[model samples]
Target: MTPPPGWYPDPHAPHLQRWWDGAAWTEHRRTPEAPTVPVPTPPGGGTGRARTVALVAAGAVLVAAIVTGAAVLGSGDDGGAETRTAPTATASIAPESPGPTPEESASEPSADDPSVVEDQLNGVTFPLVDGWVRPQYVAQDDVVMTTDGTYDCPGDGTVCRHGLVVSRTVTANDETSPEALAKADISDAAEDAYDRDAIGQKPYGGMESHELVKQGPVAVAGRAGYYVRWRVHTAKGPGGYVQSLVFPSSVGTESPVLVRFVFDAGADGPPLADMDRITKGIRPVGDAGTGGGVGSSIGPTG
Candidate 1:
């Protein structure tokens, strides 16, 4: 016997099966095969595991944001006073606005450009004016200004630091006023150079004496600070060098923004006058306090 067209008897056990279109059986025989065993996963299950992973990722992002915010706030103490009052008006020569030098003209912006000098050291950014070169060596606790270059003039056995510098941590603060900081930094720089008369000296020609000029109270980012530009119109040792100094208000973990533009006196004019102008162009990087753009932080100041 022959089975029906749509039905086929199982040869192995005499069970019946239904035929599909043409190729094989559509319905199974009376006796079916045992189901395959499934592998067991952890109790969490796949969906639960996916959810756990997502939660962990979100948690990590939140932690990172919190850490970043804290870092921005707890980095430095920049809430110093906005002191720009000029020092005692000792005999000083009036400064003429000198134009940018060839080298400076190529690299520095105009006097009105709102660029700020950035000194990044010890994980803090102190904005200074342009024309301020980072010193290779400085006198701060964390920085060291050296005299490896040709000491054009030596005072007390130290090289006359009279070139582009690249020092770390040049700006700093210590519960002091900005004016106080500028004065102290300028004085300190004079001392550091092993020259007593290079910074605070007077007497240009005839009966004129040149003094340090302090200009600022300009908006450094958003915080208030000042730039001190001074000139020493005399000869130190035999160099006949006239020095210019730039000091910014904020301080960092490394040092204050101490910059010097030196020129040998008896030249046409104070060679650093233009340099001072270029330095003046530098403003604070971002706004001073919170609400300022990136890299800005807030601190309490008296």
Candidate 2:
């Protein structure tokens, strides 16, 4: 008679049970319990304790085979020995949980936050005020530094404009001072605008011509520098200002770096004093304790 569809003592290993599907044995196996009573040995054969040990060893081998997902066949010990075959069943192991995302794993401070950002270039560092955004390409290019600001214009709902640009170049002329450079730069810009007919253009509504209102020697990071201020002539409404700070090369032979601050006065934009505040805040990128300004030793030039 065939066995029922249930667990029965393994025909090949007496210490373990194998699942039978009413026919052949399956790959599933489990140890119910260690035999409490000694397993009997064949007549005139080994002792009962020895038989028990052999049964325990067989149970261990069966466990290993199951863990490795291998099929084990057993032979029945009836009048005729019969072979049992089982289909292979693989062991299931759960997958590991995923790791943290890029945003979650990042520990560096956010660049978007309204805080000072350090710009490292030309062996100098400057503090960029809150709400200013730097472009990725600026990191690779040291000669040019640029930042932008956004605000709601009087007629226009919202607008973004260039807030600051610091352009550096190596000049061989050691005789040139910051004051001279500032004058030349402002003069050149005014001349260029006039030649291009950009002046009196309504790109900025009512912005007609540019006039140099101030030119003076200023020190930045305790170094000699000069600043030139320009007033925007507007046909109507409050006008804007353009200011440039030129710092001569710390070393006599190298060229000076010019930082320009352009503020287009919107109905809601910052004042000229606020623009000056930004200019005075310029310091070597890493210098925290020192203030940036013009040296008293330098005098203002018309």
Candidate 3:
């Protein structure tokens, strides 16, 4: 007789239930315990003992076959009914714990933080002195310049203000010496400020003329470099002193990087001594603080 369309004990092996689609078995099967029903075995006897052993072996083989069939069927449409059992078991398990917070996830050190401020691009670090604040215009990676104040130029002219300008740049070439680079940079900057027809004008009302008061070698993190001191005169009258330093990369490489420190002070602004101290205090990310004295003509060496 044909069975109804539902789960029933396998006719050949009654220990396990198999799905019968009215006319025939459809390959879906489960142990009696799985369906919450106990399979009945024949009364204890020599033949019954053997039959019971055979049923246990057949049940093991049935489980193995089910697993193998599930693997072969994969996620095909025809295997939807077979895949539900595995997912149900998975669903019973608790989900994973929540992850870290947004702040915790983004733990990168900030350059704006004076305590831990660092120039990752140039591989240098320095503490922010009192009364000096980092301006929003200067990017963190390029250079960290903190100033006592800023000069807002009047009208469309690019000059007419006086403040310190500190920055850095990294280059990949060893063809020129540090002193040569410093001289060239200073010359170009002076031309930009003093030359009326120059392509780019300097920031502070374009200096009328500038004289190189003194220039000599300096050092940073034990790496050789050079510094140039300029006595600039602008349209507004004696535009204070300007000091530029070119620091070669301390981390040894064929192509040394350059870190520039530009200090532009008005005739009545901060003393040259203060600028000298700040320049000397610059050290590679982490180094013991050392004091240095400024020279009469030129600034202090790093």
Candidate 4:
């Protein structure tokens, strides 16, 4: 019974208070303080044991403020590292296209392709004469027809034309004779349009000599084709007229087709008989449109 010193509680930390000193306990602990309650003085007549010690000190301060608000809401989730918790939201959505499928609208390119210089992968279609057309960037290929505009390059600032044309699909060599690929493609189609013009600019002032103004065999689109035609002689104005014209494909791997030509040689060019009326209007791509020339009318002489 050696108990008569100061602070008590803490019989091994019961919410603090230690310091006994009458028998042992010392290491001075603290916390546990609220209990003092002895103030009812000013009222000279308030008995009943001072109103039951002020109602037991207001019910021990409302049970120590509800156990200190339940230990501060249970240590607010280990209160310290800036609480976070927030994730649960999603909604992306997208997928619904559908439309083109007749074999992808027959392999795309229609509004433009069937317009002119139609190669449609060598099915053939280059009709359109009476001032040739098509190729206003319609997927432009191998110069593919021109001469509906552009004039200037009398020297070279670019652009000059009295006629133009080009088509492809010769699969480079293995000569399948269209008269030896139109005599080996009329000297590279007279040096690609009068020697230099596809932006390398030399305009007519280039190509100074060419000849063979005729060769043979012709009847394109109805197959059996060949052509040569030349005349070049540039270095100035009114000097042009090249040609090539192979031909084979009426559809698929009959592959051959070449077709080339220029013009410009005075009289505002375009009429070596519209190069046999555009080689008598090449057809075969479903044929039929006779508006601007149509094949089978036959175009001959070289």
- For each candidate in turn, give its C-alpha RMSD to the true structure in angstroms: 30.5, 27.8, 24.3, 38.7
Candidate 2: tens digits of C-alpha lDDT, residues 175-213 = 457887777777454332222222333334445678767
Cα displacement (angstroms), candidate 2, residue 123, comes to 2.7
TM-score of 4: 0.25
* RMSD of model 1 against the true structure: 30.5
Error of 1 at 207 (Å): 20
Mind giving the per-residue lDDT tens digits that candidate 1 earns over 1-302? Answer: 11112222233333332222123222222322222222344466667666667666654543333222111112236765442111111111112111221122223333443233233221122323333433343433222122224443433343344434222223244533444555556544433333453444322221123465444433333344444444443333323222233333232222344444344343322334434343333344233342212122211111
Summed backbone clashes in each candidate are: 27, 6, 2, 1
Highest-scoring model, lDDT: 4
Which residue pairs show backbone clashes in model 2?
125-285, 126-285, 171-255, 218-294, 219-293, 219-294
Off by over 4 Å in 2: 1-114, 135-162, 170-175, 188-202, 205-207, 234-239, 250-254, 294-302
Q: Over the full model, what C-alpha lDDT does candidate 4 score relative to the true structure?
A: 0.60
lDDT of 3: 0.47
Off by over 4 Å in 4: 1-108, 111-116, 119-134, 137-154, 160-202, 223-226, 231-233, 236-241, 244-260, 263-283, 287-302
What TM-score would candidate 3 get against the native?
0.50
The model with the greatest TM-score is: 3
Residue lDDT tens for model 3, 196-268: 3233544445567777777887665556667777766666434556666676554323234444444444454
Q: Give per-residue lDDT, candidate 4, residue 258.
A: 82
TM-score of each: 0.35, 0.45, 0.50, 0.25
Model 2 C-alpha lDDT versus the unseen true structure: 0.49
